[model samples]
Target: MALGFEELDFQQTPMGELFLRRRVEPTLGADVYEVKLGDEYLMSSLFTEAEEQLAHLGLAPLDGSDLAVLVGGLGLGYTAVAALSHDAVGAMTVVDALPAVIDWHERGLLPVSAQLTGDPRTRLVLDDFFALMRRDPEARYDAILLDVDHSPRHSLDPSHADLYTPDGLRRLARHLREGGVFALWSDDPPDDDFMADLGTVFASTRAHVVEFANPLTGGTSTNTVYVAHSAG
Candidate 1:
């Protein structure tokens, strides 16, 4: 058996080992890009429907002009790019904890990197997203799209676990303007416990299940996009 891909880059982040890989999927006869942390798969080009939907569903509900967005977790840049596709979006700031992931975009290792960096409205910030939200008490945004974790129940890092808590979610609300939207991508289905937690922080919250073809398996798979709003 020959190798289907090669490791283009790898980094030792505080959380674990981060790997960027390009592989050929013989089943579908297409090239697939993947990001892996340790032995766990974080994201892949093969399954990007939910990531894009996080932006679509979140931005679709907004009215008026010049929307400001903050994308938490740079992942493969799918959500950020999708958010920018909206003409009403005036600005977007993508924040990530790992410098190596940001470096991957700066180096043009991914498809959406060029689009995100070249656009005047987009700004990529290297920082811990949760920490930044907590630190910037006066800063606010129209929308904040988070793709940092597997789910509210399954986090990549333990510190990130706090973001799903009531205190942490309130911190996110602080950085969002009145009537602002908060959206997040989860690889798992919507969790009732998490949705209940979200209800405690925001006035309204909903979960969208995005379905896409599963090339590996015979049927389809689904991911969840959770959206909430800060009251006016």
Candidate 2:
């Protein structure tokens, strides 16, 4: 497939800002253009399968009580939107480093994101999720969905690499309540070393794949989601 490119203008949302390419190319083979949050190439409609699946992992087993969720990386807000769709979810807190990305949702740059932003259960936080995890929590969340950068390996920002490291993972893990689940979305499968480290941190660990086709590259892509439980 021949790759095509076009410049996209950006708009602000309450959570972060979104940049969209005005002229979408069929040759590029997708309806949605690149979505960037500040300097981060967050995501596009292309990989929505992975985003939606990440949300499903959190919402699928809800027991119908007050379930609060923290979503890292608002991206196009698919994960946040999907989380709010579940009746079992009482509160959904979305955190992103870029305020412009959030603003895009607030200003209706992305209609789907706007719907989620408008939801009463949604709270958009304009801070790094890692910072929030380290701070005293106003309340403990039932689930934490992390999809920052591409994966534990590739980061939109080099500093974000700490988020996947053992120390960082440990800090993020501490935020969860007993029996709470921490699910992370990776652009690629984690290596043996990474998996081994996760095993030591969580009582039980499991990983699932979300497959997608990248029309631009004409190659099949698979994203992984790692679900770690504090209490098994």
Candidate 3:
């Protein structure tokens, strides 16, 4: 029998203190895993619908086998796992700024860890995803799924702000193959201004409102998934 709560791992990173914790939710009567950065909750197993949707909606537009995918955040491995569920996805690269986060998945601390780490198609990279987008990459991807920041208007670090801009988005678009899809998960509601910027860079853009049950709250909650496609 596991204890009610346990801290799986803790690390001091350049960003802040990162913590991985597991606790039994009395209501659900199931073990829940969570990640916190500093005092802010980064991810929780309790709510994963939006994270998984980021992959499904992102890859849906793409049509081709042996597709290469890039996932900007690896939190709880939900997005990556979801992306791999598609038979079209041939390879997936998951990038995270913090090594501790990757270690958690590698060590099988998270429930979806095995689904990510055990799959030969998955490659876990320790790198700043925003930085990777700023420069030209060695190769282009068929789809890029990002769930790093809170939103285009809010970010964990100021440096990440650029990626949301039109100019920054242009840089990111260059890394994608023609007709490639870019999908982002935002905690904030859809931003019209951000949608306009996305339109400027991509051939088309759409914001999806993903609703999921909130265990903490009795009612449902929503997150935005922005999907854009490069010019064909």
Candidate 4:
């Protein structure tokens, strides 16, 4: 029998203290894994619909097989795993700033670790996602799915703020193949302002409201997935 709660791992990083913990949920009678950075709860296995949708919505517009995908923020590996579910996805590169988070997945501490690490198509890279996008990359991807920041208006770090801007988005678009898709997961509701900014960089953009059951609240919670298509 599993205990009520257990702290799986902890690490001190430049951002803050990171923690991975597992607890037996009384309501679901199952083990729930969660990650926290400092006092902020990063992600939980309990609610992953939005995370999964980030990949689905992002790739829905893309066509053809052997797709190359890039995923930012490998939290719990849900987004990366979900992206791999598509047959068209030939290769997937997941980038994260914190190496400790990558270690947790490599160590199989998280539930979806096996699905992410076992697949030959998946490449887990320990790097700042934003920094990579800012640099002149040698390769471009068919799709880019990002789930790092809380929202365009709310960023985990100030350095991430620029990525939301029109110029920053344009730079990100440069890394995408023609007609490539860019999808983002945001905790905040749809923002008209951000949509306008995305309009400047991509050919088309839409915000999808993904609602999932909230076990703790006994109701539904919603997250936003913003999908944009590059003009080429």
Candidate 5:
């Protein structure tokens, strides 16, 4: 809550005009921001918890076999950076809807993402995530991580709702390799029906509750990550 560094303005595509500032305590990890006009805080470079959660959940099924990871949405590049860290990962495909966010990384507005953007294992795809997945029936990935919107229930884009629907789940299931994982990040806990839908598509499903210390807001904030795996 206390002042840490000079405040700077960042321009997002659909969101537009974001304020990024360093956190005094940084309990969340390192860098944190209070986005103007929104209650949701932005985690920048200090993304240890989120990155670890993505990698831990996505890589659990792979027994060191080379696998391809498809990551939807490259926010702060926490998940992409984390997925690329695994040597068993043969490739990482990152798809983001907003070109402005991608430009920010290319221009170095977001340092964490910029680093991963330059990584050799990464392939950047600028497209609508849902459309991209829908068009690629033959494409298969060992793990697919989706962190596009804030949460499944509260999406910045109305179109994101389709991703949680039964039809969307079916398309997602088609893109997975045997025993592959599908991970989604949600701001709040997942609904029972949402979990059930995931179960229908994947042979197994699990939800992970991630708790992290909030520097600006006291106490702890928890984000739910839903992980589902295809039948081997």
Candidate 6:
């Protein structure tokens, strides 16, 4: 078989140039899909273990018959797909700041697009997640999964920095129903100061480290999933 490299789509957004590429990796013997902003790699289908784990660990504590979930980002549709996997999840709204990301899925350029969009429980919304959190919505959710930025301190766009602050976290908590759960995915290890701030806004807070094999490095790196349960 021949190694295939194709640029699926490209767009110029407020953030930067976003492009979706699908390549057949011969070394790994897999077809890899990736999203790039300028020259920086945003996400890839090659390594999605941590992304799926983020949803699993976050939704584990919720024991409800019909659950409503809000996912902050829809990178490659991994998180939204994982959230919809739960039988208890009656409805899920995935919101992303970048319209191009959402467009990729609707255009069927992404691998998981069909499964994610076909599911009746899923809804894709293009909006600024942080701004939406600051204001009160008509409804509250049972779980909120956030994977918009790299980490609390390090952000892809400087504007997202405010979401991790104490006041910003409180805004997020207000949008959740009583006893709701808030989860965040970070490429770095858990931060003590951030967790301390979570304690102020939430009743219970903890960080989960997800370790997976790195194909290129032949070693393991960890991703942290920070979880905070509502005080009510």
Clashing pairs in model 6, backbone N/Cα/C closer than 3 A:
none
> Clash totals for all models, in order?
0, 15, 0, 0, 0, 0
For model 3, the stretches where C-alpha displacement exceeds 4 angstroms are: none
In candidate 2, position 189 carries an lDDT of 84
| Candidate 1 pairs with clashing backbones | none
The sequence of per-residue lDDT tens digits that candidate 6 reaches over residues 37-60 is 876788888788889987998899
Off by over 4 Å in 5: 1-48
**Please, what is the TM-score per model?**
0.96, 0.84, 0.98, 0.98, 0.84, 0.96
Best by lDDT: 4
Write model 5 residue lDDT over 63-164, tens digit each, in one string. Answer: 656688899887677788888778898888888876755665677755575568788888888888888777766579989998867777777667778878
How high is the lDDT of residue 215 in model 2?
77
TM-score of 4: 0.98
Model 5 weakest lDDT span, ten residues long:
28-37
Model 5 TM: 0.84
Q: Residue pairs in steric clash, candidate 3?
A: none
lDDT measured at residue 16 in model 2 versus the true structure, 0 to 100: 55
Q: State the lDDT of candidate 4 residue by residue for 34-115, as single tens digits.
A: 9999889989999999999999999999989999999999989999999999999999999999999899989999888998
- The residue-by-residue lDDT of candidate 3 on 59-137, one tens digit each, is 9998979999999999899999999999999999999989888998888888888888999999999999999998877
- Model 6 segments beyond 4 Å from truth? none
| Candidate that beats the other on lDDT, 3 or 4, i.e. the better one | 4
lDDT for each residue of candidate 1 in 96-173, tens digit (9 for 90 to 100): 999989899999988788997888998988888977877866567899999998899898888888889888898889
Q: Output the better candidate (1/6) by TM-score.
A: 6
Q: What C-alpha lDDT values do all the predictions have?
A: 0.89, 0.75, 0.93, 0.94, 0.74, 0.88
